[model samples]
Target: MTWSLIAKDVDGSIGVIVASKFFACGAVVPYVDAETAVATQAFCNPLWGTEGRLRLSVGEASTGVLTDFVRRDRGQAIRQAHMMDKYGEFAAHTGSECIDWAGHLLGVKHSVAGNMLAGPDVIEATSAAYLAGADLPFAARLIGAMQAGEAAGGDKRGRQAAGLVIHRGQPHAWLDLRVDDHADPLNELSRLWDVAQERFVHFANAMPDRARFSGTPTRHQIDEEIAMAEARRKAEGRGSRSHAVEFG
Candidate 1:
């Protein structure tokens, strides 16, 4: 019912993943370790959802956490999950009874897993696109990977919703956006991300962070940062025609 990839950026300061499938996709398939930046996904096992993430948050190793969950769950044969730790340790489980085309691929600092997919090619395309877009912004790279997976024949049943969650040094997500229902969820997600960059990202950058406990930028400063971001966006060939004259 879902396909997802969890990966850490090259510099190790960011981790992100994108997931999509049928209704309520965001609610079911993703989790992040707020403290450690480990990511976890549980498919077909509602009970294992938060527990898996909790384990990772408490410093449990990825493989051991997944192994123990499988061994202890009575419905293990029909459920699946994949995990990646901040240190690059990874593990995945595809229960024996999951639908056809169910499996996972573990790569350096990344892992992809899905069930009810078009074919194994879905996973391959996702992994390839992610690695190929290493130079793109973390959120964009993840969306690119999801788009590639869709092109490779995404969910055999068809798409309905999608989500992208990314975290940097903060305990909360740097970007957490979701399309709970849409005809083209991934594309919608990309659009929303662009809108975020227009002003939200720059405004967020001005907010206080670890090193800047009282560092909120002045309104004039925020406007300057937004202008700089717009210039960068245009230079990168993604400029929008609806550029506003000024921010209120």
Candidate 2:
């Protein structure tokens, strides 16, 4: 009923892009954090995300977390999950009892997984797109991958929700967009992502981060950052087909 792409961004961030036939896949599938990112689906277990993140935060290995989570679960054979550490090490699992066309792929530092998908092509296309978009922003790269997956044929059951959650070198999300119960969730997600570029990303960039605990920037300073961000967007032709457009 779902598929996802979990990867480490070029900027050392972790991101998750997920879509499903289920409503509010965002509320269940992807568990994103700066230090580690995980997605648990199939006969879904919501605890995997929260508990896995805590384990990763405490210095556990991604492979260990993924294996341990699945191993300890009584319903392991129906579960599907994958994870990546901030350092780019990663792992994936596809339960034996998952529905037909269910499987997963692991790239250099990323993994693509799906269950109840249209076919193997869905996961393949998704992995290919993400691997090919090495120059795009973390969020854009993910969106493109999901778009490719959708083009190949997404959830066999049909699509209703899609979500993108990214943690760009922060414990909190840099961008978290969801299209719940939409006729075309991934496309709707794309539109919301573009809207986020208008101001949200810059504001998120200006806020106090883990590295800087105090002395938050002034509103005027934030405005300056937003201006600079806009200028960078213009320079790189962001939202268009361009390359290495780094801001925020």
Candidate 3:
């Protein structure tokens, strides 16, 4: 089974996707918010996201359209999926023919999933994490939820890949972090999230002065800033960690 958390940024303008699997599993989820965001997935339905976005662009209410789509899927009995849109509207389906013990759980702006966990407690923990308003990063929040779920009763199959995506302001992605294979995917995802933040900081720093400050920065000023930051980094023993390092 699968669970996904899709949300807009705090201002209600971005889109995010975070999910967990019992193993190599991923969601067959789909979503759309014509005025805000659109996303979808299936065991193989990549076009769900694209088509949903198009529908939103043409002026459709995300919830109404998604509800209609799911209800129309005669194949709804074939997969386990969840979805959320920019408006905070959400939906999920667990096919009758899905693996035994498969199910999904939901909370405000969040959904939790597990296929072979001890019971429904795994998803309950994830929902609780979202509802409790934890202070962790998006990935950490997801993993925290997963961990709580696991503590309650995780997958009988154990862990595998995990993914996190967040988008705010821009109709596209801001965070697309993942751990494709791992003994502990949620933990790896947490490490990758740290690396993603550091990469963003470096990218921000390397921006052309016009991009960073909205005005040309003198080459001298740029050099001085770089030197100062490098000095600080070295002094703090944070040296030589390149952007290429794999946090996962």
TM-score against truth, every candidate: 0.87, 0.88, 0.69
Cα deviation at 209, candidate 2, in Å, is: 0.9
Ranking by TM-score: 2, 1, 3
Q: What is the C-alpha lDDT profile of model 2 across 1-248, one tens digit per residue?
A: 79999988766878898999999998899988877888999988888888988888778888888888877998989999988765677888888999979999989978999999999999999999999999998888999999999999899988899999888777778788888899999888888877677677778777678788652567887777768767887898875332236899
Model 1 Cα displacement at 17 (Å)? 3.2
Query: Global lDDT for candidate 3?
Result: 0.54
Q: Candidate 1, residues 114-215: lDDT per residue as tens digits? A: 888999999999999999997898888988998999999988888888887776666667777888888899888888888888888876777777778876
Cα error, residue 126 of model 3, in Å, equals 0.4
Stretches off by above 4 angstroms in model 3 are: 8-44, 56-59, 113-116, 201-248
- lDDT tens digits, residues 145-207, model 3? 666666776665666766665543343444556666678776676666655444353444344
Give the C-alpha lDDT of model 1: 0.77
